[model samples]
Target: MLNTQWRVLFVFIVLLIASALIANHLTGRVFNYHDPIGSVRAIYEDIKTKIEMAEESELTAIKTIAAPSLSAKTAMQKHLPQADTTRCVDVSLGKVKYKRNGNIYTWTDSNGVPHFSDEKPDFEAATLDTDFVEPLDYFELTLHAANLPPSFTEELRIKLNTVFKVYGQIIGVDALKKVRLNLTVFATRRSYEQAIKLRGADPTNTDGMYFHSTNSALINYRNEQSAMRTAVHEAVHAVNKAILGSTPRWLNEGLAEYFEYTKNSMQLVSVEPHPGWVNNKRVAQSVFTINWLIGLDDTWQTGDDTKLYASSWAAIYFMMDSNKGKQFLKSIMLAEQKSPCSKLTAAELKNMLYQHFPQLDKDYRQWLKTPFRKQSF
Candidate 1:
């Protein structure tokens, strides 16, 4: 194809120069004609030489443009964040059930196969330095408990980090990674309540609470399953504040409720129909209009906790169920802090919401009226 182009270009150049040469020859002959064949032959040789050189130059230019630079591609790839599979924590060895200091013991069997155990051998054994999982630069969790099983505590920690990963995938790891999340787990309800009280939070009817001032999560271990859910829920809030600075009440609560139940995976792994606030029938009768939910700043005194939570959960469920919905949600998430700890005004956030989902009020209400279980998306 390139050769064809070059040949056609050469032919066009030859035709153009031939026309010019004919005109020049006529003018020269009118003035003084002598050795016209020699003059024409000399002109033809010069044009041919120049055209050949021009064609080579043109081919060089085309080749330069056609070739891709492997060095440039490698440089671009260096700027992109590489995925670390080791960073995905479904379980944490950091929460050691039994103390073995910091190292894990390993040995080889008679068949020259590797064997692993917590026990140290008398001879022919090597110790593998398996350190506890280090915390991210901006995130840390401390389990302040003396009675809870270390195994269960590790499981809870895994679930919480999974929440971080889930939102990290959504909001971006760069943002979530810089999030300063401090989570503390209390062994008993009495101690948990005391801790929240000391933080000046009224722990009247809550299993867990996320204090935005300190960017920390405080949890009460009432039961294994419930406490795990609460920890996951609060972890989402910590992540939210770290990434977005502050989110609307509906968004904050909806995300919390979403991750609270969805376990061990980035998405709804089971998609199971559970009797959570998201599946609550009260969402259908919620007082929150789409506009109201978007405009709400900090006034959470809605009188009915169930309906409020259910409404928020429903709105988030509807937003996450479609590609457009997820896009809309992502738009709001990108509203990061402008000043130090500053937030976007209600008007700004409202504009973003409408811009992304114009008929959000009507569309949200319509979505809530759909069949219930599929909200798991």
Candidate 2:
């Protein structure tokens, strides 16, 4: 009986130890069974992992939702008629008529000088040539304006005509006979920002924008200093899109920057120094190379906005400043006409530049180093 009890006790002890070890092994997979604090830390880490995955999923969903809007914009841009420089001049249509704003009477005096006023001027009825003038057909302008001088819009119209004539002469092409343009001149800056937001564009650090979706240019008269320059800058974009058809971003913005500081007097176009590029020469040499500039798709893409503008403006300045450069410009534009919808590769464009001016890379840098006196095209 004593020997039987001893065996039973030994067996019971052995079984209890085995059971305890089994429980510890199962709990060890997650955490130490003896450590409550370790279990709490493990639970926290698991929750953190789950939360991180959820956040990643949410970000992915947001991106997916935003992608279609970008695609739609691309499609709309593609839908536009992409005309080349060669045929841009040849598509001259009928002249546009002035759709005058409220109480706006426009007429030329006996001396053939044009005039416009909100208050009716004391002029003979026969001198009223409002019905006959057709300059508006070339530049279709819609003005959402108030409390502005009647002369403001009229003067703007005349200036835009000068722009057409001068750029036409520069490129050796006739100006398009019709271009539909919308200019919204808000009375206050608040109204302008609100308008930009409504169009789904950021209004920070900008006074104006040419919205592709709306096919309109927006500006405000609150800061009158940069208003006209901004207007002409954005207008050039609209005209380029209509005439040149998807001009390369470097060239497009370069041209806009070139013309923004224009002195259009007596039907002549003269370009002044660009504010973004002119004074920042040393920085430009360090930041830009001809090959790099040509490769850039847009300043926004690289987040190199200022240097990009500076480089582009410098490039255009160098091109228009010299006879060979003008020849090069003409050659580029002519070559681009052949492939309107297709953009030339960086290597292809670089090769073309070298073909025209074998030392263009060196020449461009030299021009930027020296202070340019005049860049008139």
Candidate 3:
């Protein structure tokens, strides 16, 4: 009876040892049991909370940074009043019938009738003839009679600052120094059309002009937004004049178009190649058709006038499309500065361009092939 009792006690002790080993293995502990699950859950919750807090802090920082940079109100006040002016010229078709204000000349028509208007009959359409007189003294900001809305002048000024900032960054210099702009806002289509006629008649004649100066610009205010776009385009012209001085016509128009289409955040969003004589197809056609007659050197000077502006803009766009294009443009500007205006013919300019940038032609051709994608401002 004693031996049987001892055997039962031994078996009971073995069973207890087996149970302890199984528990240790399941808990991943060889010698002791530990509840690691609770600690891991606690760490995970702590990390998740910290991540969310960091995101909130980042948003607060952005707001703080953005608060002080807005100047829409102040910019408007300074620029709106400065842009008002009227541009008119007196012209005589025949002998003077009466002369009022030594600047104004009146004449009689061939039919023995007296007529009076602001401009002379002999003056060509779209041209400013010195023979025609302008009574107003030149001001920095000149607007045609009743052209712009009171609210838009300030907005236009702010946009101008933005354009200059971006342009200066791209060109690596202060472009405003070399260029000055005169903004002309015309209220009615008649005034706008009249201004266009005056300017168009003598495209090459620069006397008694509104925007005839290379360093200066003139714009029509179709609306506040159109006025802004016009400002951007003209501002770029000012920048180009400052940075590159006198550029090839193709390049000049191209760079202007580039800025016209590419400078605004809105423009980049919906960029389509301009069509017709003013843009893409006409420009490309000019290159192919005129390459033989004018050659690449003089192509810019006397190609299809319509395409010249468009193609030039395309070329500028191509150059600004990538980092390489930016660097190449910088080099071109440097080369231009070194070359004297009188000595720099188209051929010499082209040679210099090739010398500095072997890939320019190739890259330009490639840019012509690439599809355009519009961007929002």
Best by TM-score: 2
lDDT by candidate, in order shown: 0.59, 0.62, 0.45
Cα TM-score per model: 0.56, 0.60, 0.47
How far residue 82's Cα lies from its native spot in candidate 3, in Å, is 25
- Model 2 vs truth, CA RMSD: 16.5
- Give the clashing residue pairs of candidate 1, or none: none
TM-score, candidate number 1:
0.56
Comparing 1 and 3 by lDDT, which wins?
Answer: 1
TM-score of 3: 0.47
Superposed model 3: Cα runs more than 4 Å off = 1-145, 174-178, 193-216, 220-227, 262-302, 337-343, 356-362, 374-377
Off by over 4 Å in 2: 1-137, 175-177, 280-287
Error of 1 at 28 (Å): 99
lDDT of 1 by residue, 1-377 (tens): 99999999898667656645663754332211355445556566666777799998898778657855433312211110011223212221121122335567898788999888768777767888885443333346665555567886677666666565555445554444444445677787799889878966667666777765555677777667766677667777766655565556677777777666664455444222224542354343445776676666454542245555666777676766777777777667776533314456778777877887888777877867767654332
**Could you give me the TM-score of model 2 versus the true structure?**
0.60
**True-structure lDDT of candidate 1:** 0.59
